[model samples]
Each structure stands twice: as C-alpha cells, then as structure tokens.
Target: MMLHAGSWRELDTELYSLTDNNTHVSIVVPYTAPDTVFEAVQSDSIRARVDLLLLETPNMWQLNDLSLACNFPLTMTECYPNGTVTALAVKVESVRNLNPKYLTLSDRSCKPVFSNDRFAFFSFNLNSCGTTRTFFDNVMVYENEIAMHHSMGKHQSRKGLINPDYRHTVSCYYLVNDTETMAFRTRPRNSDPKADPGVGQLVVQMRLAQEVSYDLFYQTEDYPVVKYLQQPLYFEVELMRSTDPRIALVLENCWATLHEDRTTLPSWDLIVDRCENLDDRYIVFYPVVADARVHIPAHVKRFSVKMFTFTTDETVLKEQIFVHCDADLCDTTKPDGICSGQCASPLRNAKPLKPTGSRRGIAADISQHRLSSGPIILSDSSNFV
Candidate 1:
C-alpha cells in the first residue's frame, strides 16, 4: 500500500495506455488541483462511486481474492473470486485521521504492497507472474456536489499543452453558443450540480481533429455517391450556421481532381462562380454542378471537392469533401456524361423536327438535344386539357 498524502493508496490497471505494451502510460487530470493544495489532510473524508474492473488473466492455475477500500473499515465487500471485476459506489463519510500505522493490509499470504504515491490505490488477487499485473481505470471520487479526486497513471508527463483552436463550423454549433465571438467556455467547478461541461470542449476538439485529418465532410449531413462516367453530380459548399445573417460569405476554389489523376496532376477549375455568396445556411435549393470545364470526362472517378470561405473581406475557413462517381451510386437518371464530342455538331445540319409526342407545338432542332417532362396530352384533347 502507498501513502499519497496522509492516506494509503492502491493503484492498478492502465487506463489511457499510450503504447501497445502499456509502456507509454500518461494521466491527464480531469479537474484542477484541490483547493486545499499539497497539504495532506488525513481527515479529509470522501464519498466515491468506485468502478473497479479486474481483467482476467490466461493463467488460471490458482485463484486469489482482492479487495480495495479508502478507509480502514472499508465500506466494500471482501475479495471476490478470480475472473470477475468489482464495481461499488461506496459512501465513505467523514472518517477519523489515518497514519502509517493506520495502513490496512491483508493478513493473508500475498500481502499488498505500495508501488506509487498517487491519488488512489489498487490491489490484485493474482499470482505474481511476468504478465499478471493489476489494471485500474476510471477511478472517480466525489464529495457533496463536487468531484473531489480522481486516479492518475504512472510516469505521466507534467507538460502543459496549448489549447488548440478547435473552431469548426460543424462542431462549433454544439461547442460554443456563439460562433462569431466563440464565447461561453465550459467549466467543471461550476455550481450547476451536473457532470463537468468541460467534457463538451473535449468532444468538440476530438470531432474537429477526427474529421479534419480522418474523414471527409459535406454540406449535407448525408453525402451521395454517383456512378462514374455514367452520371453527373452537383456538389456545393455551405455554412452549418451563422451568428449574423447579414454578413455575406463568398465561396471559392470549387475544384476537384480524380483520385487516379492526383499523381499525374490533372488541371483544376472552379465548380461554381467565384462571386457566388451565401447569406444563410439554407440557401441550397438547386445544386451547383462540379463540372468546372465545358468538357467533362466519363469514368468511375473518386475525387475531392475543396472550397474556401471569405467573411466580409478576409478568408475565414477552408474545407474539403470527398466523393466517388460510379454508376452504382448514381442518384439521378439524367446525368450529363463526359464530353462525347459527337453532340457538339451545329444545329443547322438537321432538318426542322416536328413534335410527334402527345405534347405538340414544341418544335426544335434534333442536333440540339434537351430534356423536358410534363403531363402528356392526347392529340385531340389539347383544346380541353
């Protein structure tokens, strides 16, 4: 058993292990240092909902019993059999002061020993072997309405990291109340009587980092897939939400290049006009086509759509979305395929075509192909219908 301040400690298991062999283990405190500072208050009684998960070992030749408690007269059950974890929400109220002699130990053969002087302590009910080591994680201690103490890991780095600007439009909606100002930071010590809102900040950072380097994003919550060369797609860039609806956002670099052509370095062009501006998030009714050049290709293509956003006169954000083009994922029937070069002929070469379908009076040159759909009328019913 280890004595951190004035109380004994027992640490087990490796939670947040950084390496495959749990060699690079580090612990990040959820909250700040205690208000009492480094003073060892043996009488600082606490009430905790301890969650002790005991992982089973492959060797089952011998079975041992392990138990854990903060107070001498621990409000917990004795050692349970092997291959099972213990979860107890003990209500350890104000107990008397404890010292080195107050240290609680097992009178049995395998006496508990102290390894480190961290916050919480751990015990094992296993036969000592090269791989048989106790692992404890998520040891949360609460008192009254505040989360008093939590367990930390071994050989932890005491380095301070700069808080990253995890301000993505998508995650910012849930992280910050106002995007333009980025206000309302979450605090764990608040008097809200709820779990730390600081977790939401981590969630926002994780989401931004995860999507930025891992997966692609799109304006629509649901991204579509198109059949390559057989279909056409209309992709766009839009804001998730806006703090001010009056401020205009100009989008640029609506460009794409096939995955296969990424190495060969294909030419890139704007998917939409540079002057197009978005006043609101819901201004998407007609989709903006991705074909920047008049001559588009027909092939099963996997490409990315990258865009830049400018608020007022300054560039604010730049993002990209990944997509694949194939017939299997085509969402529309009238997909403008790649440039065939045969249909570019002059319309004067064809004779004046007469309307033969139910819809008449629609005369056009056959060479200039187009598509239109409506309720068809009978030849004699045009007068009434």
Candidate 2:
C-alpha cells in the first residue's frame, strides 16, 4: 500500500522490492466508507488489479458516478451507499483531477505515495458547535504511525518538532454594524465578457487588499476542553489570488522566542526548515504585511489564509502570530504591520536602496542602532554625525 513516485526506473525498483515479480497490475480508485474502501483494495483474491482509494466528502459523491464515462474516471469508487464496494459490474470511468488514488489497508505495512499537486488532506474534528477543519497543506507521506494505528495523537507529542506547549489563536477582520443597519452600497455589476476591464476588473482590485490569517492546531478537541502552552510552529503563509485557485508562493520569514534558558533562539538547519522552537508558555510575536497590489482574479469569497502545523510527536503547544498592516496608523504597543516599530518622529525620506554584500540577507533598515544584537553601527564616525 505504500505509494511513491519517480521516473520509470525508480518506480520499477520500488515495485520490484515490494513484489519481486512485477505483475501486470491494474490501478483502481475507490471512494466512500474509508474502512470498506480499504477492504476491497487490500483483498488478495482480486488478482491482476492494484486498488487505489480517493477519500472524498459525502456531498461530493456524484463525482464518483462513473457509469457514463468512456473509461474509468481518474478516481475509482470503492464503496457506494449499499454494501457494494467496487462497482465493477457497471462501467466506472476515472474522473480527472480527483485525488488519493491509492490506499493500503494494512496500517503498519501498507503506506501510500501520491504525486505532487495532486492531493491534500483535511482532518475533521466535530464538536458541539460544528466541525472545525484542519488541512495538511501537502500530498506526501505524513509520518504519523501512532495516530494512524492507535487513534491517539502522536505528531503533537514528538520532540524536535513543534511541541505541545503553544498558544493557538487566529485574528479576523469582520464588518460589525448595528443590528438594524443595512450594509453595502449597490448590487454587483454585470457586464459583457467582451468588454475591457469590465466589472470583474474593479472587483479583483479591491479583494487583493485584504489578507487572512489562521491558527494552527495539531490535535482537535472540543473548544472548552482544551488547554494550551506556548511553543513554536512552522508557518506556511500563502497568497491565493482571485485569478487562480491554487495557493501561490509561500512566505519564508519565521520568528520564535529564545530557548527555555533565554540563552539563544532555535535555528533552522535543514535545507528548508519551516518550524521554529521556543519555550513552553512563552510569547513570540511577528508581523504580517500585504503589498495591496497582489493581482487577484475576479471572484473571491473570503480573503482568508489557512495555517496548519503538525509535529512528529504528541505535544500540543498553543501559538499566536499577530498579523497587521504595514501602515504607520497602528497603535505603538502592538505594531503588527508598521515599518518603523513605534517611532513617533516624522520619517525622513530615504532614496530607493539595495544591499551590496552580506547585508543583503537582512536588508530592512528600519533601525539605525544595530542590525541584530551585533555591534555594527550605522555611522561609525565614532562621534555622532
């Protein structure tokens, strides 16, 4: 059940290792009832066919109706509302763009591999209020043996990842008015598609100004029953343009507090490290800014961002990262967006600038004192200019 992707040679090697004699394997995509979906896929009696399952929501089952397609849709339906698992008797065609093409029923033994940009997962936890959804932002082998097997949260307790002690909170922008007040100016304009910069043009421009932020939770529980401590998290902030449905480039900046001893902050050593480390119950604040000209498509429901985090262990740490505007109008105490911390002095007009050397790595000259804790001064004329 473990799935992987690569060139033909690499895939051949993997298949050889799993089943020495590479047989003519037919790939099947199944949906509905995750348990029964796996049962049909793992049956050894079904020779000559390798079963794949695409997990889907109940509301979207119509996509699995492959009775009319010429060939199996990109996905194969496993279990229907009835006891039928795989509707092989009826002609089932694969639907292109549907995901999770494979499933391994054996928990420890069968692992699933997925292709890039093909699939993503949503971990749903239902509470009294409603269902809160947490999305794992990628389609890859997420190493969560404990949770997968024991139904116990393991990723949250892992050591080197984001530990259990982080405060998790999200800030939102909502339009609050008197209960009886009527909102908005006019109905959306309708225009001909043939016209230039039609109604779609203005709609897209305004949507780009708003940015969204969300809190990440590794494990889900009822809102009232949860307790949180402070820790670091790997943040993946992406700008979703209205023109495109995909999540665009991910932000690279990250921030965390000093270690438990206040000696030094944790550093990322991997080729690409996303998680930050911090003390339990500690507070780390970082700012978020939007360019205001992000170039979005016409139709946008909510300009919201989705933040997700997972540890290799089972500890839950609550975290809060405040996002604000880059303008100088924010309060001095929580300057989430301002460029000049809380300086009240009238700003001097500086010329357009670029870094020349190593300083290029850290180019925001928001301070004249020192770049970091380093002793490099702005004007080393020893005496004040």
Candidate 3:
C-alpha cells in the first residue's frame, strides 16, 4: 500500500557516528529440539527448545545452533566453516548523536507468529568489558537503557556491568506511531543533578538493523524542506546473509544532520511493488559472496530486494536462498513478493506518503538448518516414537 499525503515537514537535528571498540556481541534466539528424542522420554517429560545464537566479536562472528531444555548438553556447532561472520553483520559501528539516543526492541510477545517477517530490528549498547569508573553517580548507561556501555563505564568505580535493575523497562526509546512523528518531551532525568546530584553523564549509542525492501526516511518537524510523497527518497542499502534464511539489511540515511528540534520524524517505507515465485531458490556462499533467497513473510507491510557478492569463486553458487522485492516480481496478484531491482513504474494503484520510523528479518537460512539437522520441533515428540 502506498501513501500520498502531500509535502512533508523537516525537523532540525544533529547526528554523530560512534566508533567501534572491537568486541563481540551475541544475540541468542532459543528454539526446541526434535521428535526423536521425545520418544525415549516418558509422557510427562518437560518440553525443550533450541537456541540459534548469533555471536559478533570485533574481529570475527559466528552462528551456532544449540539444543536447550535438555538434561544433556548438546554440542552447538559453528554454522560457518571459517568462523567468519559477514563483515556486513559485524561492522555496525555504534553511533552517538548530540540528541539523546533512542533505544527500542521488539517486545518478547511480539515475535512474529507467522513466517518471522516482522521487519525486525533493534538498537542497543555494549559493555562486553568490565566497568572502569569510581562513583555511584558514574553510571552513564543503565542496565538495559540505551546509554553506551563505554560512556557508563567511564564514570563508575566498580568493575563489571552493574545492572541495578533489569525488570524495569530496559529500552529507553519509543516506537513512532504510524502517523509519522516522534515527540521527545525531555524532562529532567530520574538521576538529574541539582536535586539528586551527580548521576553521571547520559550518553546514548545509535544502532539500527532492519530487513530489506523498506526505506527509512527522516525529516525535522521545523523546516520548509518538504518531501514529495509521490517520489522515492535516496538511500544506501546493504544486505548480509548467514547460513540460515534469516538475513539482515542495513539502511543508513547519508543526509547530514539538519539543525531544528521541535519533533523529528524519520520514516521507513516499503518500496518494492510485488512478487511471483519463479523457482525453489537456494542460498549460495563463497569467499565474501553470501546471498540467500528471502521468502516473502506473511505479515510484512512492504518488500524490497538487493543483491551483493563477496567472492569471485563459483562455489558461492546458490549455497543460500533469498526473497527479492523488485517490480517485475511483484504485481497486482503478488503484492507481497519483491524483485531484485527497482520497479519499472510506480505501482499503478499505490502512492508514497509520509511514514513514522519503526521496528524491525529471514527464512531461507531456516530451511537449510532444518534440512541439515532434521526437522526441529519444540512441542512434545513422544507420540511420533
């Protein structure tokens, strides 16, 4: 669906890039094991799940499939042979903006119930190392707040991540409504000085991860810099594929920070037209060449696709699968599928409109794992035996 509401407003703002400190970060997705094992266990046995862990260190990163909820520790193997994570996935340098950074994550309850097509992305900070400051007020980042681990460690005396509270809302950001606007009513923080005094510096780090086919556009709320809803915005998009169907695409607004601040609204719009499934696709891998066929998720608002190559070797030939959202692939009948290139014409029935930047990726990498490891099921498997 296209949005066409007319000229847009611009907000004055500031942007800054954060430097990477060279540490590995891990994102763990847990799942259940298989039906075979369930047969041996009694009918009353508790269920177990599997964990798909994605680990990213400064120099290298890897994906591992581990079985959880089992009495025995099942060895988790490295999905990648060389243990090299695509640079695209690990090179996300943390950014620091003059404005306080916004931190947000998809709620646990919001996990895509369908095909894992929630356009999922999250922003966060890292404290892979122990702390290095000396004072109760030295904590810049909260246990789960958006503050940079670097900034927080700079103030505290005690070492190690001192998460005083984790139950509270860990993310210090808000989701922009579909109306295309974010209102930041900055009030004195809970740790503000004058009254509470010496609560350390409040620094937020910027990190964004989103699926392909969507363009995130930003404009301040205060300028005449109008955006025509009928035209597509310019952006730089990149994609990275893992051994599994889940891939990640990053969109960085190359536009310099505009100076206004009433309320800034950045928008992410689905740009691809539609799709037609031509073949049973496969993911290919080689030196630097990692590509996967992305399946059109059931609940995605928009779909788009781009191709990337890393190796000149033919071994990279179709080791993976991916979904494309180009115009040719997407038509009136298949509005959800995207082709690999830009659409030839505007979607005949759709128009572009202002959007509010928001949340959050893949399935091909999924099938490969299932095929290699046998079918995965978290529910009880005893009946099968």
Candidate 4:
C-alpha cells in the first residue's frame, strides 16, 4: 500500500501465506515481492539513510524487519587516556553481502584495523579518524561515523533491477572524560580565543554553590541568569587532565566585558597580577582545596564577584557579561615557585613568572592559557516579581 494525503491506498495485490495457532496468528510475505513498500528514513544523526518496512493491522502499525536496513551495531570497544591523547577503539557490524574492504569511516581511507566475517574493528586516537568535536551544555562531544558503500555486480544485473550505488552510515558518539585533555590553545594577546589542535586545555565555568566549605559546586548554565547588584556569581577555572601530583593551577588575571570580544570598550577587572582588583571590593577568592569532592592534583581555582553592570555617564548598560581569565600550570613541588606567591600589590614593569618544573618528564615551556565563560544575564530583582 502507498500513503497519499494522509490516507493509505492499496497499490497492488501480492501472494501471502497465513498460519493460525491457538495463541497467535502470523502472516508471511515475500520481501522481494513487487508490492512491498519500503520507506526511506534518515538516521538519528542524519548521517545515514535507512529503509524501513512497515506492517499495518486493524489498530496499529509495526516495523516488520530491518533486514534491508543498514542499521548495524556500533560499539565502543575501548576508551582510555593515553598520555597526550585519548585512545579509542570502536567496532561496527559489517553489512551482510557487502565487502568489509569497502567499509570505512568518514575519512574514506580509514579502513578497519581488524575485521572478521561479521564485525569490523577500528582503533585510533580520539582526535583522529575524522572525529568531530563539539561543546554542548559544557560537555565535550566527539562523534565519528562509519560508512559502507556497495554497488551491484555486473553478473547480478537483471531487467528492471538497476545496479544503483548503495551507501550506509552509522555514527558513534563519545563524551570527553574529565581526565582527558582537549586540544585547545590560548589566543594571542588582544585576540579572540579558539580551539586548535595539539595543545592542552583549561576549562573555565561559572558555578553555583551547593554546600559549605566549597565541597560541592555545580556548574551553572552556559548563559546563567543572575540578579543585578543583588547576588554574587561564582567561577572556577580548571586544567584538564592534571593527573600529576606536582602540578598546580594558577589564575594570573581575570576580567569581564559586556561583549564576547575581549577588547571591547568598558571592560572591568576582577583580578589582576594574581590578586583581587583593589577597586573591586566585592571580589572574593576561594582557596584551592583538595578533598574527596575535588580532584587530587589541585588543578582548580575559584572566585566570585558581586553582580554589577557597566555604567557610563550614570547610565547603566545592562548587557550580558562575558568573563575571561589568563591561567597557567605550575609545579607545586618547587619551593617559592609561581604558585606559592601571595596576593600583593601589582608591580610596575614587572615580568610575569613562568612555571618552574616539568610535567611527565617533559620540560616544555608553560605559557599562560586564556579561557572564557558566560553571557551571564543580569536581571533586575524587581523583574522576578
């Protein structure tokens, strides 16, 4: 049958067999019959197409079978941190009657590392294999798709049966673990920050206090709502995958602006020179503490600022605020190092201190990484009513 204008119409008649039992009745039909209807469906990621067969009854409709569909199992075989990269392994069920040699990932040449008659296995770094990374609700998502391409052979050609190209795809999703490092880089001074390949990342977020003693702080929404001049906004900056016990995180400077463009006019300083801005009396810094709730390496820094808006000529510009911070990683084992300094007055013509020790035996130059969070909307207290 075919559907037309919200109604089903009988397209043609076909031969069928029926069986009746005391418990149930079954009807069997040939899938290769001329009257068989197959509906094309786009897979969840819209990266693949599937053909579905439907069977209709008196009161309901049911999917008959996915025999002609490309719906195959995609499983994560392994996911673990491997030094500078996250090692990942995935397996896909090979399409029946399709050569496994033609089955590969989005990068057409990325063939399966291992394969049998039924399943094809792939292994690579998470950053490889044509994986695309995106951020959703503060969580990093990594996605990779596998595809199978097949064309009918000349020997199988038949009248009215075209040898059309057949393409099937299935996608696999992986979330970045907290201990895994993301490939991100800090922007040059006075430029916009962006994600780049082959660099460590620092995650900065605005959080809400859940318990006393800073034991439990939950990340707020990407664009958090706040009350203007009535509440304080808390923030945290963390270095990803800081598994070494000797490493420490430091925030060298932090500021807020009315726009995502950091260089926009009318920026406000909350912290400068590793100290709270002297002009912002309401700014508060929370000491980094290690406990069951927080990670052991102490790669996190926290602070809070009372909500306020940028004002000019006594006119308040109640725009969403974007907070940005320059951070660095230091070796806490080094005595009197960059991380051990106390908040003091900003010095004139003073050079910024670099981290003193190595990480994982690699003596690479540690630079200040910049991270930003927000678009924090400050609503008037009266607006709540």
Q: Which numbered prediction scores highest in TM-score against the true structure? A: 4
Off by over 4 Å in 3: 1-236, 239-263, 266-352, 355-385
Instruction: Show where candidate 1 strays beyond 4 Å.
Output: 1-228, 260-264, 272-385
lDDT of 2 at 68: 12
Candidate No. with top lDDT? 4
Q: Report the C-alpha lDDT of model 2 over 70-171, residue by residue, as the tens digit.
A: 122332223222222221111111212222222122232322333223332222112211212343443211121111222224544333232212211111
**Candidate 4 local lDDT, 283-334, one digit each (tens):** 7777776677567636777777766424445554455778777776676777
Cα deviation at 285, candidate 2, in Å, is: 20
Off by over 4 Å in 2: 1-193, 198-234, 240-247, 256-385
Candidate 2 deviates by what RMSD? 31.3
TM-score of 1: 0.16
Ranking by TM-score: 4, 1, 2, 3
Better of 1 and 4 by TM-score: 4
Winner on TM-score (2 vs 4): 4
RMSD of each candidate relative to the true structure = 27.6, 31.3, 38.9, 24.4
